[model samples]
Target: FIRLMAKPEKLGDLREPRAYLTTIANGLVSDHWRRQSVEQTYLDALTLYPTEHQPSEEQRALPIELLLQLNTLLQQMKPLIRSTFLLSQLDGLTYRQIADQLHVSERTVKSYMAQAMLHCLRLKNQTDN
Candidate 1:
């Protein structure tokens, strides 16, 4: 199990073999499930979208990849922050309108919008690498 669970170099330098192996295995398992959850959510969304509006084969892959990145970023955000961002961007609402709709102050809406933009820039940086 040690041989399978950890890299050879990790095993060679391990001060506590069992602890090291367990940590490595746990990380691997966590990453596996994270990727799986992202994939499942993307597939579920695609299914619910109107079939007539689906992208062509040549255009499909990039959007799907970008969508997964966007979804991951959005999932990490607060619910109100996500909603404020979407309403402002997708619905083309003004800050006052979002503040009114969300029953929050305009200052809070601006802060949420800033947080959302930072999240998007972080995702863009990740993709660039």
Candidate 2:
């Protein structure tokens, strides 16, 4: 691993440090990617599991697992875009309310909302299939 990371020039008779570091870095990246893949696979499996039923008192807009997934997806978005989308859609804010809060024009607010909706829909379609 270190050898790859170091990418050392061929040594006539001695090893170089760069090759070693490069090798190590390559291994780390591969391992990191593997771990991420495993995590995503697990999360996907969890999405298929049925949520527990709550009493009338505990029912909510979405099940906990679904909400967690949504939160994770939202994290991928730019913060301002996410905020605008959530405020307008989830929180039921009007376009004017969103514009006032962000101090942007109403047209800008509408544009942000459209972009966010498209991103969300694309993500949903991918996951659903």
Who wins the lDDT comparison? 1
Q: Supply candidate 1's per-residue lDDT for 8.
A: 72
For model 2, what is the C-alpha lDDT against the true structure? Answer: 0.73
In angstroms, give how far residue 37 of model 2 lies from its true place. 21
Worst 10 residues of 2 by lDDT: 53-62
| All-Cα superposition RMSD per candidate | 5.7, 10.3
Assess candidate 2 and give its TM-score to the true structure: 0.52
Cα TM-score per model? 0.59, 0.52
Per-residue lDDT of candidate 2, residues 16-59 (tens digit): 65776787789788766655665566556565756563323244
Local distance difference test values of all predictions, in order:
0.83, 0.73
Clashes of each: 0, 18
